[model samples]
Target: MSDSAVSTSRALFERASVVTPGGVNSPVRAFNAVGGTPRFIRSAQGAWLTDADGHDYVDLICSWGPMLLGHAHPEVTAAVQAAVGRGTSYGTPTEPEVLLAEEIVGRTPVEQVRFVSSGTEATMSAIRLARGFTGRDVVVKFAGCYHGHVDSLLASAGSGLATFAVPGTPGVPASSTALTLVLPYNDRAAVEQVFAEHGDRIACLITEAAAGNMGVVPPDPGFNGFLAETCRTHGALFVTDEVMTGFRASSRGYWGIDGAQEGWVPDLMTFGKVMGGGFPAAAFGGRAEVMGHLSPQGPVYQAGTLSGNPIATTAGLTTLRLATDEVYDHIGGVAETLKTAAAEALTRAGVPHVVQSAGTMFSVFFTDPAHGPVRNFEDASRTDSTAYAAYFHAMLDAGVYLPPSAYEAWFVSAAHDDRAVQTVLDALPAASQAAAAAQGGAR
Candidate 1:
């Protein structure tokens, strides 16, 4: 049984805080947004995380959307074991990189792919390549679309709709964001205005294929296609960051559901998460013409020492091969079931909420239905963080772990069998009640 005391977790957190910046490697994991002692997971397997206190909970985060087959998947583990038997990173190109790259090229619109160690590198490299290919200085992005922590991309929307962005964080200098134009997500007019004014200087307009960072605010129907068309019209590259969605949001990522149907292809796409198969592998790729401009072939250069580590690539390859139709079907059904149940629970508890999804990835907003359909960062900001914190703790107490913040996607895996699903479903009523209680007189 799970304990509310969390005494051991508290102690470990205290110890870790002395060494680590915030007692966690990632800011979100610190529970700063949720207001509680974050559970330190000792291990995970088959849709369950065993915390340091030996309490097991249903894992809804799924390592921020990578473990589609679920934690400690047998086949993936076996592949990695075999790979480790050979050796770890060699700093030299290996067979697994070739195989994994081939798999990526087959699955997406990317014509040629270059491996990287993380989503950040993939985005940073893609942007550089875009600038190089266009010989332009400006880059456009949308609010709520997180494309990793690249210096230029770490920017907030400026004072006006068509203005250049200001630094969103303290460390980012104004000069870093000087050339970035940040606009609202789903606002086509804003996009058109920015391009109309700065199209010649704009190298690329990058956005998440679906905005999962702001709790899965999916691109409006025909939205991504619109971006592609606009960029094409201006000779600017259209770059879609699929770091959170690739493979997790359908076999080929969110692009599979949207771009494939719309018949538009991005000039560049950055991928991570599911492609890494829970490892640190990531990549960026695009049409042959654009990709040819990257390193050895042309001028834009990007390299990583552990870009395609054999163990990581082997694990990613195995996971991708195993991510079949059945895997997606299972995850989608589970997501639908859970989202429906949570809606019902929230309704019963008198807590107005809206649930949004991007393929299999989804998030429940602690906002009213009337003000919903969160189309941009401002709309996403209306999500009641205080209510979410209460709900998060309530769910944690009930043995279903959600994302530490409201502004994040919930993931499910083929391994989320009946037992794990039941645990979450069982927890929803109480969680909704907590949210309702916390949101008193506000909604």
Candidate 2:
């Protein structure tokens, strides 16, 4: 097909611009960083996306890390369909909510879990509960760690905020973020210094279990464990925001890689993405002692109109049930293959790059590893986004879709079979060359 054949998406984007802010629901989806028309997807199945212009590409974003089993898995779709036939939403308590909550508790260290409609809600409510429980006014978050777009967490956040180069969101009052201490991601010294100054006043310190939003920057050895210990010492709750890493990174999430092995658990945890089975379900939970502070059981009040909606819960529960060790094994194998292939291709093309991972989740950084791992947002920001934009467009042209921005993880799923993986491999050499030839950020 000719390049002009894809004009349908351009037209749709133009129409959307008139009605929607930035012509996209999410900031990153607008392709502003990449400088191209974002493909308007009509449908996705298994590991492929079919765009409105009738071109099909192997999907690598996986709805930004929710489609662990890949898009529209037969079993998950069947569960959601059966749930829909019963009824869409019922504000009343449902069996699926209890079952889903139980599944989460069984897998992680949480004794109880509370459902929410989105990751932002989960993190927002988690922070509120922490503040109320500790009776403290301050929160501490890592600079590159994103815990959704919650006003407090958005201060110096990763993901979209980092991708767009926003220092901190404008509308969020300075007072809202004044109490939020932003520190470097893997720097124990910075975390220690901040805690030494404000430990007693801190309600919670939240970090991504593994920093996926800033392109899969995994925690340094024992970094998360150290944070948990410090929080314990300082009487502040350690909140692990696993919205992107949960289930997709591993069967039990990044905690399964670190906490499960190291025998340290967070005081609180937030989850979303794969647990919802491609629906809008998320949660926050921890020890029953901490969770008891929320709602009718305690003074801290948090409620949602769509909290524990039946259909969403059903989808989440079913997805969690089907996420066995085999699913994680398959995803891991695919990620390993792709990571190796991408690194090799970049090296062959004489492109300076670094590949990083947190279990099955990973990303190829456009910066050289000589600068060291991207432990914080500053390091992540040093990436060659212009090189990546060229690489991304080349891959898109080769019928393989990559994340539109350099600071996002390239997600793989159990559905990324040899066929899908081969498509990506076939596209890599040319993409790497494009990246090598371009002057990053000069465009």
Give the TM-score comparing model 2 with the true structure, all chains together: 0.96
The TM-score that candidate 1 achieves is: 0.98
How do all models score by TM-score?
Answer: 0.98, 0.96
Q: After superposition, how far is residue 95 of candidate 1 from its true place, in Å?
A: 0.7
Off by over 4 Å in 2: 1-3, 157-167
**Candidate 1 accuracy as lDDT:** 0.92
Please estimate how well model 2 matches the true structure, expressed as its whole-model Cα lDDT: 0.88
How far residue 253's Cα lies from its native spot in candidate 2, in Å, is 0.6
Residue 322 shift from truth in candidate 2, angstroms: 1.2
Tell me the number of clashing residue pairs for each predicted model: 0, 0
Poorest stretch of ten by lDDT in candidate 1 = 1-10
RMSD, every candidate, angstroms: 1.4, 3.1
Candidate 1 per-residue C-alpha lDDT over 1-443 given as tens digits, one digit per residue, 9 for 90 to 100:
24456778988999999999999998999999988788988999999998888888999999999999999999999999999999997888899999999999999988899999999999999999999999999999988888888899999988998889999999999999999999989999999999999999999999999999989999889999999999999999999999898888999998999999989999999999888889998999999999999888899888888888898899899999999999999999999999999999999999978998889989999888897588988888888888998999999989999999989999999999999999999999999999988994231
What is the clash count of model 2? 0
Output the number of the lDDT-best candidate: 1
